[model samples]
Target: MKTIEKNVGKKNIVLLVLPQVQLLDIAGPCDVFTSATRFLANDQAGYNVFIVSGTSDKILYSSSGMSLPCSHTIYDIDFPIDTLLVGGTEPGVLHEINSDLYTYLRHIVKETRRIGSVCIGAFALAKAGLLKGKQVTTHWKYADLLQKSYPELEVNINPFFIKDQKIYTSGGVSSGIDLALALVEEDFGTFLASEIARHLVLHLKRPGLQSQYGNALPDYDMMSSFTKEIRDLLKDKLGQAISVEYMADSMHMSVRNFSRVFVRESGMTPGKFLEKMRLDQAKNLLEYTDMGIEMIAGKCGLGSVVSLRRLFLKHLSVSPAQYRKTFKRAD
Candidate 1:
């Protein structure tokens, strides 16, 4: 693990933005770096963060229709860049970008210490052939398209962010903040990163392995009528101790037949679906209320705090308390 101690002075963080880029992808990481400077001692070095436009335009319009003024183009930067991040744009606009931007990216890779993308900016990096055979991620909705377009890359949509050697890619818009905080933690230490997160009023500094979707339910439209009925029943009685036999009886079928039909319709056994439903309920309670762990556990039919912790750890890689801290609504 290398640190900013290797660098002699302030590290230069250059974010590249194009027309119709997502604003948060540019603003989030920049704010993280700028905020870090406020906590640094006068003698200590910090980050010099700036934006460079990929196009020749002096001003770029974001996807949200906000205008962003840029003083430098990619060609204008001659100094070494410690980190270079690409902000995301719509998929349609990605196709419209000029080839010169890809050439510039290929050329700039030689001068940068590290490079990364926020959201669908992975497409730009992929277009430049910078991510061949790399395990990466983008927004979950576009994960399949990214993989289909670039067969050589492994696209995993689970995590909020991921780092593969010197290259990084984040899940969606706000995950840029998570990625930037990670970079800060890497350059300095956890103490500085924690301080920055607190100042930003961030509830949780999520790990890279944490799933982007949490325990959210899959699309109901994709489920069969039988599966939907079962889901409805489970939702109403999530706090009760439900057995496979009870489910079978409610559906008016033999236990064996119920198991086979449920698997056929839901793609999972009744027990597995029940557990997933319980986990979803538990997550909802954790995020929306101030209930204690034991009460939440009982209400979700998870039995005890130990069982609840185990369920969260197995599925989410985070403890119940940690998940609550990260996602709980503000009072």
Candidate 2:
């Protein structure tokens, strides 16, 4: 690795690229730094950005068919990389990364001040032995694959991003921008980061602790169609007083058989699944509406505000009011 001459106080931000990289994973963060150069006026842009291919300095096409011409290759760039960021490749293209690429990544890890990945790029980091036992995250869809592929790594698919020591891992595409903004906040200040976020039209500087679970019940797709129908019934008729026997009767199965099959297929008991659906609905209503807690509970089939409160406390460790305070968005 060659070290570039220091330019007073500028940070060298290098994005490691590969063929068929997720384009947003590269463009989003790079645009942030480029925009930051203008936002942080008077001072020369605090970062000098570079894109380098792990194999060769040539044109590389992204997953979305966008072509980027790269002038620097890992083997050619001896510059000091203040921060090294790797963009993700589609799963189909993931096999293109060879042993030489991992070796280069390990070498760069030794030279760069901080090294991180965007989305499934964490897979490469894990391959390079950089994420052993470290808490990280990636796209929710790929989280299980990453975990199974690297049993030594701790892959949580919840948070928008995670920072464990010098390695930062972000969720899917847009969150890469959030991760970059967070880095800007750390290096510059909250005001600058917030301003950049505002410039990007983002609502707020979302913290890493925030979950990526969208406002919907996680469907148990592996379950039988009959079981899924029962689950759908529970969601649709949340306000009604329904029993396990009723559910089993609807599915034309005995209560004992229904319970066993439901649990085996869905990985959760029927009762627990119903409760989860109701609770997830209640949470969505609270975040997006001004409905009172009692009304929300009634609507979601939690029966009453007291029942909803107890469930929230038991499962989420927060009361309804506190949850609303933290998550609700103002119109």
Candidate 3:
């Protein structure tokens, strides 16, 4: 394994792009690094960024139907990579890495200073055997699949990014920018990274361990029809406090029996599941509306701003105002 200290002069940052690549995953991080060079002024400490593919001159279409230009192919590259990143593709798209590509990845990893994947790009890294015994993260939607398929790897769905020694992995979409900012902070300093983030108009530099927002509904296929009914009922009544007895009665079961079965099927106690659903709804309202904290809390059945604040702090390490400020999209 090569050390980043061995690299001098401008580091070469390369991104490997597969077909159906998520455009934002590549562009957002690339822009972060590129902007750092500008922010550095006369520092002369920056990355030389470029894109590579399995084959040259191939016009790869993004998942959103945009064409991306590739500068080089894996078969032709001869330079040392200071950092290597694999950008993500749409979920469930089959990635066929031939022996040649796999061989190249395995060989290059030995010489590269650092390597990482963005979102579902973890699949590629896991396939290349680069993520063995490493704690990693991906888009929450695919976290379960990644864990099921690669039992040897530790897949965490909460964090926006995870770094196990020199290997790094990031969660979905814009989280790639957070990973890039972290790399910039590592290579340069917080001053330059913060400058680049400000230039990009990012709200906050989210820590790697911040919990990811997930769907409110539980997986129906994994639960009984009665459990699904409870889940549905909870979804519609997120703003109201419903007791375990009420939930059990809705499913025609005793409270003790319902609690046991709920945990067995959903992997969470009923109380915990209800809390998660309420938090998700609160997050949605925070991002999409201009509701006041007290109103939003009442709407989510959190009862009061004080109660919501406690849950937000416990789960996200941020206050409701902070979460809203950081994640609210500009209209």
lDDT, candidates in the order shown: 0.84, 0.78, 0.80
TM-score of each: 0.66, 0.67, 0.72
Which candidate number maximizes lDDT?
1
Clashes of 1: 0
Task: Give per-residue CA lDDT, model 3, range 188-306, as digits (tens).
Answer: 76777777778888844665353546544334564556667777788888888789898888888999998998876665688987887788889889999998999999999989999
Alpha carbon deviation, residue 263, candidate 2 (Å): 13
Candidate 1: deviation at residue 298, Å?
22
lDDT of 1 by residue, 1-331 (tens): 4333322478889899988998999999998989877677534577888789998777999999999998688868767899999999977797787789999999888888889999989999999999998999888656656776788999877788889988999988888999999998888777778888999888447654535264434446646799899998888788889999999999999999999998777666898889888888898888899999999999999889999999988878789999888888887
By lDDT, the candidates rank as: 1, 3, 2
Candidate 3, which ten residues in sequence have the lowest lDDT sum? 1-10
Clashing pairs in 3: none
TM-score of 1: 0.66
lDDT of 2: 0.78
lDDT of 2 by residue, 1-331 (tens): 3222223477889888888888898889998887767776635446888988867647888888888887698878867889988898865566765678888888888887889999888888988899999999987666756776777888776677899999999988777888898888777767777777898887446643433244223436534576678877776788888789999998899999999988766556788878877878888888899999999989887788899999877656678898888889889
Candidate that beats the other on lDDT, 1 or 2, i.e. the better one: 1
Candidate 3 accuracy as lDDT: 0.80
RMSD each, Å: 6.8, 6.6, 5.5
Task: Tell me the spans in candidate 2 whose CA falls farther than 4 Å from its real position.
Answer: 1-7, 42-45, 207-210, 213-331
Error of 1 at 228 (Å): 19
Worst 10 residues of 1 by lDDT: 1-10
